[model samples]
Target: MKNISMKNVVMGSVLAIAAVTSLSANATPVCSGTVAGNGASFSAGTNFVKVAFTPKCSANVFLDGEETSPTVFRVGSASLKGKTKFGGSSVGGSVGNMGACTGAGGVCSGTDSAAAMTAASS
Candidate 1:
């Protein structure tokens, strides 16, 4: 009985350690601070890349000065993508007359340093 209990504890510890490590490794790009805006992540394949964002703003997000794919269309929360080697993807949010990608009125705004293309998972 004692041996079995010891084994169980060891196994549990290993699993816990693995879970923590995996979570840290798989952590996606995060955005935080005075703006209190959204978070973003990406999954990339050979032919295409998929990006998703959690909208915490009152407006839309823009990519490369354009309001289109890979950004929410005039709303909150969005998922989109682009082809491989999509180039540098600059991120910003538009909330009313809040300027270009500038977070205001309880919205968070900033540019993501993430690659336009990344690995299979963030």
Candidate 2:
């Protein structure tokens, strides 16, 4: 009887662990293209880390073209690849070490060129 009880406990523990691991992977986080812009940033506070994103072109984008970004931001670095969807397209993401953010900039640069090309192509 003791042997059977021990086995049950061990099996329960294993199942619990597997369940937790599965949930962790699925809970990574997700965001829509609500918040898009140049020099946009988010911080997990000191507890997690500070994350920032910069644009290389004219980027003053808004979520759904509204006027703000999403409330929850899931940033990824080169070492920690992430995902993002914007401008009716899904794009990959990358974030670096947590520190003073010197992200990209282009609120009025290549972005203009991109828009022009897009218009011409259309």
Candidate 3:
């Protein structure tokens, strides 16, 4: 009976480890590339800020953004190929403005242009 209990514990541990490994394998890849013609515009109808940009990457990637705090905006996710565009909205105010922008996927960065309604990745 003791041996059976120990075996059950070992099997449970193995299953847990396998589950973690599977999750890591399916994790989304980061975005890496140069951003060009990146810009943002506010839509009064939807009360959300719309962002558009073209990332020059070797492979396709996913891009996402949200309002982190107040007027701050953060963009993240996998690498990109061809053209990519995403929108972000703020929860604090009626008018949404992208005060800052960022990127993910290894070493990635971005700049926010509130005046010109544009953003660029670096």
Candidate 4:
């Protein structure tokens, strides 16, 4: 009886895990297209950058970039100044790490295999 109970518990746990994984996998929506007019704002105190762009897949989307290292910038705002192609699933309105940012006229770029998108500012 104990063996059967343990088997049931293991099976239940596996099924619960699978269900959670499936739900998470399906939560992200696929998005693709060209993005333009990339721009970013940096908050030095928090080490956080916010990037905004016009995406063909949706209206203007803002993505967040958190920097691990301290960032130096003469200006808090930067113009990404170019267009790039993006194809991938969007999580919380961002296509993977598409907007990892740099400051002081630096470029932002990233690629995510799960989202299948690459983004760069020129």
What's each prediction's clash count? 0, 10, 6, 1
Winner of 1 and 2 under lDDT: 1
What is candidate 1's lDDT per residue for 1-122, written digit by digit as tens?
Answer: 65344323322322322222111122233322223344333333221123332323212221221123332111111112111111111223222121222223323222321232121111
Quote model 3's TM-score.
0.21
TM-scores of all models? 0.19, 0.19, 0.21, 0.19
The global C-alpha lDDT for each of the candidates, from Candidate 1 onward, is 0.24, 0.22, 0.26, 0.23
Q: For candidate 4, lDDT tens digit of each residue in 1-122?
A: 65344323322322322222211111222121124332232222332223322212211222222223223111011112212212221122322123323433433222221122222111
Best TM-score among the predictions, by candidate number:
3
**Residue pairs with clashing backbones, model 2:** 34-63, 35-69, 35-70, 57-106, 57-111, 58-111, 76-94, 76-95, 77-94, 77-95
Residue pairs in candidate 4 whose N, alpha carbon or C atoms collide under 3 angstroms: 88-115
Candidate 4 accuracy as lDDT: 0.23
All-Cα superposition RMSD per candidate: 18.6, 20.5, 19.9, 20.6
The CA lDDT at 120 in model 2 is 22
Q: How displaced is residue 48 in candidate 3, in Å?
A: 7.3
Name the better of 2 and 3 by lDDT.
3
Please report the candidate that would top lDDT against the real structure: 3
- Where model 1 places Cα greater than 4 Å from the true spot, the runs are 22-122
